[model samples]
Target: MSDTTATPTRPVNWTAISITAAVVMGGILAALLAVAPRDDGGIAWFDPMIPGGWMAWTLPVAIFFWCIASLLVTFTILAIRFPETPRVGVLRIETTRGDRLFISLLGSAFICLVWLFFAGLPVWGALALCLVYAAAVFRWV
Candidate 1:
Protein backbone atom coordinates (compact mmCIF):
# COMPACT_ATOMS: atom_id res chain seq x y z
CA MET A 1 0.00 0.00 0.00
CA SER A 2 1.09 3.55 -0.65
CA ASP A 3 2.37 5.48 2.38
CA THR A 4 -0.26 8.02 3.57
CA THR A 5 0.95 8.59 7.08
CA ALA A 6 0.76 12.31 6.60
CA THR A 7 -2.99 12.25 6.20
CA PRO A 8 -4.83 13.48 9.25
CA THR A 9 -7.37 11.34 11.06
CA ARG A 10 -11.08 12.04 11.60
CA PRO A 11 -12.22 14.87 13.82
CA VAL A 12 -12.02 14.47 17.57
CA ASN A 13 -15.12 13.62 19.59
CA TRP A 14 -15.95 17.07 20.86
CA THR A 15 -18.72 15.64 23.00
CA ALA A 16 -16.26 13.60 24.98
CA ILE A 17 -13.79 16.43 24.98
CA SER A 18 -16.41 18.81 26.30
CA ILE A 19 -17.22 16.35 29.05
CA THR A 20 -13.62 16.23 30.09
CA ALA A 21 -13.47 19.98 29.96
CA ALA A 22 -16.45 20.14 32.23
CA VAL A 23 -14.86 17.73 34.67
CA VAL A 24 -11.59 19.60 34.75
CA MET A 25 -13.31 22.93 35.25
CA GLY A 26 -15.35 21.40 38.01
CA GLY A 27 -12.23 20.11 39.69
CA ILE A 28 -10.64 23.52 39.61
CA LEU A 29 -13.76 25.00 41.08
CA ALA A 30 -13.65 22.47 43.86
CA ALA A 31 -10.03 23.28 44.62
CA LEU A 32 -10.82 26.97 44.85
CA LEU A 33 -13.71 26.40 47.14
CA ALA A 34 -11.66 24.14 49.39
CA VAL A 35 -8.69 26.45 49.71
CA ALA A 36 -10.56 29.70 50.26
CA PRO A 37 -10.56 31.03 53.82
CA ARG A 38 -13.68 31.11 55.95
CA ASP A 39 -15.00 34.33 57.47
CA ASP A 40 -14.47 33.33 61.07
CA GLY A 41 -12.23 35.71 63.06
CA GLY A 42 -9.65 33.00 63.75
CA ILE A 43 -6.18 32.81 62.34
CA ALA A 44 -5.92 29.64 60.24
CA TRP A 45 -2.20 29.65 59.54
CA PHE A 46 0.19 27.05 60.96
CA ASP A 47 3.23 24.97 59.96
CA PRO A 48 3.22 24.71 56.16
CA MET A 49 4.52 21.13 56.28
CA ILE A 50 1.66 19.91 58.40
CA PRO A 51 -1.22 18.38 56.43
CA GLY A 52 -4.12 20.61 57.48
CA GLY A 53 -2.61 22.65 60.23
CA TRP A 54 -1.99 25.76 58.16
CA MET A 55 -3.40 27.48 55.10
CA ALA A 56 -3.90 31.02 53.91
CA TRP A 57 -6.76 32.56 51.96
CA THR A 58 -4.48 33.77 49.25
CA LEU A 59 -3.40 30.25 48.37
CA PRO A 60 -6.78 29.31 46.94
CA VAL A 61 -7.17 32.66 45.24
CA ALA A 62 -3.81 32.20 43.60
CA ILE A 63 -4.77 28.71 42.52
CA PHE A 64 -8.05 30.03 41.17
CA PHE A 65 -6.27 32.58 39.02
CA TRP A 66 -3.88 29.94 37.72
CA CYS A 67 -6.70 27.59 36.75
CA ILE A 68 -8.47 30.44 35.01
CA ALA A 69 -5.34 31.15 33.02
CA SER A 70 -5.09 27.49 32.04
CA LEU A 71 -8.68 27.48 30.89
CA LEU A 72 -7.92 30.50 28.78
CA VAL A 73 -5.04 28.62 27.18
CA THR A 74 -7.28 25.67 26.43
CA PHE A 75 -9.79 27.99 24.79
CA THR A 76 -7.09 29.49 22.63
CA ILE A 77 -5.87 26.06 21.59
CA LEU A 78 -9.35 24.89 20.60
CA ALA A 79 -10.04 28.08 18.72
CA ILE A 80 -6.84 27.88 16.68
CA ARG A 81 -6.80 24.12 16.05
CA PHE A 82 -10.48 23.53 15.33
CA PRO A 83 -11.39 26.73 13.63
CA GLU A 84 -14.13 25.07 11.57
CA THR A 85 -16.17 22.99 13.99
CA PRO A 86 -15.71 25.29 16.95
CA ARG A 87 -19.22 25.21 18.26
CA VAL A 88 -20.23 22.15 20.25
CA GLY A 89 -24.00 22.21 19.61
CA VAL A 90 -26.85 24.65 19.19
CA LEU A 91 -28.51 23.42 22.36
CA ARG A 92 -25.43 24.05 24.46
CA ILE A 93 -24.38 27.33 22.85
CA GLU A 94 -21.77 28.54 20.41
CA THR A 95 -19.07 26.98 22.57
CA THR A 96 -20.25 24.34 24.99
CA ARG A 97 -16.91 24.01 26.65
CA GLY A 98 -16.77 27.69 27.36
CA ASP A 99 -20.29 27.64 28.66
CA ARG A 100 -19.59 24.74 30.97
CA LEU A 101 -16.43 26.34 32.25
CA PHE A 102 -18.27 29.57 32.89
CA ILE A 103 -21.05 27.85 34.76
CA SER A 104 -18.66 25.79 36.85
CA LEU A 105 -16.63 28.85 37.70
CA LEU A 106 -19.70 30.86 38.61
CA GLY A 107 -21.11 28.06 40.73
CA SER A 108 -17.87 27.64 42.60
CA ALA A 109 -17.59 31.37 43.15
CA PHE A 110 -21.09 31.45 44.48
CA ILE A 111 -20.35 28.61 46.87
CA CYS A 112 -17.26 30.38 48.08
CA LEU A 113 -19.15 33.60 48.62
CA VAL A 114 -21.87 31.80 50.52
CA TRP A 115 -19.34 30.12 52.74
CA LEU A 116 -17.69 33.44 53.31
CA PHE A 117 -20.99 34.84 54.54
CA PHE A 118 -23.17 32.36 56.35
CA ALA A 119 -20.97 29.53 57.58
CA GLY A 120 -18.56 31.77 59.49
CA LEU A 121 -16.27 28.78 59.62
CA PRO A 122 -12.61 29.14 60.41
CA VAL A 123 -9.98 28.53 57.77
CA TRP A 124 -9.55 24.87 58.72
CA GLY A 125 -13.26 24.21 58.80
CA ALA A 126 -13.72 25.80 55.42
CA LEU A 127 -11.04 23.51 54.11
CA ALA A 128 -13.09 20.50 55.12
CA LEU A 129 -16.18 21.88 53.42
CA CYS A 130 -14.21 22.59 50.32
CA LEU A 131 -13.00 19.00 50.16
CA VAL A 132 -16.54 17.70 50.45
CA TYR A 133 -17.76 20.14 47.81
CA ALA A 134 -15.08 19.05 45.40
CA ALA A 135 -15.87 15.40 45.94
CA ALA A 136 -19.58 15.87 45.47
CA VAL A 137 -19.23 17.97 42.33
CA PHE A 138 -16.75 15.59 40.69
CA ARG A 139 -18.63 12.41 41.56
CA TRP A 140 -22.13 13.67 40.98
CA VAL A 141 -21.72 16.14 38.15
Candidate 2:
Protein backbone atom coordinates (compact mmCIF):
# COMPACT_ATOMS: atom_id res chain seq x y z
CA MET A 1 0.00 0.00 0.00
CA SER A 2 1.22 3.50 -0.83
CA ASP A 3 -0.06 6.92 0.16
CA THR A 4 0.81 9.97 -1.98
CA THR A 5 -0.29 13.63 -1.91
CA ALA A 6 0.31 15.83 -4.93
CA THR A 7 1.13 19.44 -4.49
CA PRO A 8 -0.70 21.78 -6.82
CA THR A 9 1.49 23.98 -8.96
CA ARG A 10 0.03 26.57 -11.32
CA PRO A 11 2.26 29.07 -13.05
CA VAL A 12 0.82 32.55 -13.51
CA ASN A 13 0.09 33.49 -17.10
CA TRP A 14 0.44 37.26 -16.90
CA THR A 15 -0.13 37.83 -20.59
CA ALA A 16 -3.41 35.94 -20.59
CA ILE A 17 -4.48 37.58 -17.36
CA SER A 18 -3.67 41.03 -18.72
CA ILE A 19 -5.50 40.39 -21.98
CA THR A 20 -8.58 39.03 -20.25
CA ALA A 21 -8.68 41.92 -17.81
CA ALA A 22 -8.33 44.43 -20.63
CA VAL A 23 -11.12 42.85 -22.61
CA VAL A 24 -13.49 42.67 -19.65
CA MET A 25 -12.75 46.23 -18.60
CA GLY A 26 -13.13 47.44 -22.17
CA GLY A 27 -16.50 45.78 -22.50
CA ILE A 28 -17.76 47.29 -19.25
CA LEU A 29 -16.50 50.73 -20.19
CA ALA A 30 -18.04 50.46 -23.65
CA ALA A 31 -21.41 49.51 -22.17
CA LEU A 32 -21.21 52.39 -19.74
CA LEU A 33 -20.35 54.88 -22.46
CA ALA A 34 -23.15 53.55 -24.64
CA VAL A 35 -25.71 54.01 -21.88
CA ALA A 36 -24.33 57.28 -20.52
CA PRO A 37 -26.66 60.25 -20.66
CA ARG A 38 -25.83 63.66 -22.07
CA ASP A 39 -25.82 66.85 -20.06
CA ASP A 40 -27.87 69.94 -20.89
CA GLY A 41 -24.72 71.42 -22.52
CA GLY A 42 -24.61 68.35 -24.89
CA ILE A 43 -21.52 66.88 -23.20
CA ALA A 44 -21.39 63.32 -21.86
CA TRP A 45 -22.51 63.23 -18.25
CA PHE A 46 -19.90 60.61 -17.38
CA ASP A 47 -17.12 62.47 -19.16
CA PRO A 48 -15.02 65.07 -17.45
CA MET A 49 -12.35 67.44 -18.72
CA ILE A 50 -9.07 65.73 -19.53
CA PRO A 51 -6.23 66.56 -21.95
CA GLY A 52 -8.72 65.84 -24.70
CA GLY A 53 -12.34 66.84 -25.05
CA TRP A 54 -15.07 65.06 -23.12
CA MET A 55 -16.58 62.38 -25.39
CA ALA A 56 -17.30 58.66 -25.61
CA TRP A 57 -13.89 58.16 -27.23
CA THR A 58 -11.99 59.99 -24.49
CA LEU A 59 -13.12 57.65 -21.69
CA PRO A 60 -11.84 54.54 -23.42
CA VAL A 61 -8.65 56.31 -24.46
CA ALA A 62 -7.97 57.42 -20.88
CA ILE A 63 -8.76 53.94 -19.60
CA PHE A 64 -6.37 52.45 -22.14
CA PHE A 65 -3.57 54.75 -21.02
CA TRP A 66 -4.24 53.84 -17.39
CA CYS A 67 -4.22 50.14 -18.28
CA ILE A 68 -0.91 50.60 -20.07
CA ALA A 69 0.60 52.23 -17.01
CA SER A 70 -0.71 49.42 -14.80
CA LEU A 71 0.69 46.79 -17.17
CA LEU A 72 4.09 48.47 -17.16
CA VAL A 73 4.24 48.37 -13.38
CA THR A 74 3.11 44.74 -13.29
CA PHE A 75 5.65 43.74 -15.92
CA THR A 76 8.43 45.51 -14.08
CA ILE A 77 7.61 43.56 -10.94
CA LEU A 78 7.48 40.29 -12.88
CA ALA A 79 10.82 41.09 -14.53
CA ILE A 80 12.47 41.40 -11.12
CA ARG A 81 11.43 37.76 -10.53
CA PHE A 82 12.13 37.86 -6.84
CA PRO A 83 11.98 34.60 -5.01
CA GLU A 84 9.52 34.22 -2.17
CA THR A 85 12.00 34.83 0.61
CA PRO A 86 9.72 35.17 3.60
CA ARG A 87 11.73 36.43 6.53
CA VAL A 88 11.05 37.87 9.93
CA GLY A 89 11.63 41.62 10.00
CA VAL A 90 12.35 44.11 12.77
CA LEU A 91 8.65 44.02 13.68
CA ARG A 92 8.95 40.25 14.07
CA ILE A 93 6.59 39.73 11.19
CA GLU A 94 7.08 37.38 8.24
CA THR A 95 6.71 39.08 4.84
CA THR A 96 5.68 37.39 1.60
CA ARG A 97 5.36 38.46 -2.04
CA GLY A 98 1.93 40.04 -1.60
CA ASP A 99 3.08 41.73 1.57
CA ARG A 100 6.09 43.24 -0.14
CA LEU A 101 4.03 44.49 -3.05
CA PHE A 102 1.45 46.02 -0.74
CA ILE A 103 4.15 47.68 1.37
CA SER A 104 5.97 49.06 -1.67
CA LEU A 105 2.79 50.40 -3.30
CA LEU A 106 1.55 51.94 -0.06
CA GLY A 107 4.93 53.54 0.58
CA SER A 108 4.97 54.96 -2.94
CA ALA A 109 1.52 56.48 -2.51
CA PHE A 110 2.57 57.95 0.82
CA ILE A 111 5.71 59.42 -0.70
CA CYS A 112 3.75 60.97 -3.56
CA LEU A 113 1.20 62.47 -1.17
CA VAL A 114 3.95 63.94 0.98
CA TRP A 115 5.61 65.43 -2.07
CA LEU A 116 2.33 66.97 -3.14
CA PHE A 117 1.71 68.40 0.34
CA PHE A 118 5.11 70.05 0.32
CA ALA A 119 4.78 71.54 -3.16
CA GLY A 120 8.10 73.42 -3.23
CA LEU A 121 10.32 70.59 -1.98
CA PRO A 122 12.70 68.74 -4.33
CA VAL A 123 11.05 65.59 -5.74
CA TRP A 124 14.44 63.82 -5.78
CA GLY A 125 14.28 63.72 -2.00
CA ALA A 126 10.92 61.99 -2.14
CA LEU A 127 12.29 59.45 -4.59
CA ALA A 128 15.24 58.76 -2.29
CA LEU A 129 12.90 58.42 0.66
CA CYS A 130 10.71 56.00 -1.27
CA LEU A 131 13.74 53.86 -2.12
CA VAL A 132 14.78 53.75 1.51
CA TYR A 133 11.21 52.92 2.52
CA ALA A 134 11.08 49.99 0.08
CA ALA A 135 14.42 48.65 1.30
CA ALA A 136 13.26 48.91 4.88
CA VAL A 137 9.96 47.20 4.07
CA PHE A 138 11.72 44.29 2.42
CA ARG A 139 14.14 44.08 5.33
CA TRP A 140 11.68 44.58 8.19
CA VAL A 141 8.03 45.19 7.55
The residue-level lDDT of candidate 2 at 40 comes to 84
lDDT of 2 by residue, 55-103 (tens): 6445545555555456455645554555566777776878775677677
Q: Per-candidate RMSD vs. true structure?
A: 11.0, 8.8
TM-score of 1: 0.37
Candidate 1 per-residue lDDT, tens place, 36-139, comes to: 55457542433132345555435544565766777786776676556644354423445444554565566666676777797765555555665676554433
TM-score to native of every candidate shown: 0.37, 0.42
Q: What local lDDT score does residue 24 receive in model 1, on the 0 to 100 scale? A: 80
Worst 10 residues of 1 by lDDT: 42-51
Q: How many angstroms is residue 35 displaced in model 1 relative to the true structure, after the best TM-score fit?
A: 20
User: Can you give the lDDT of residue 13 in candidate 1?
Assistant: 81
lDDT of each: 0.59, 0.66
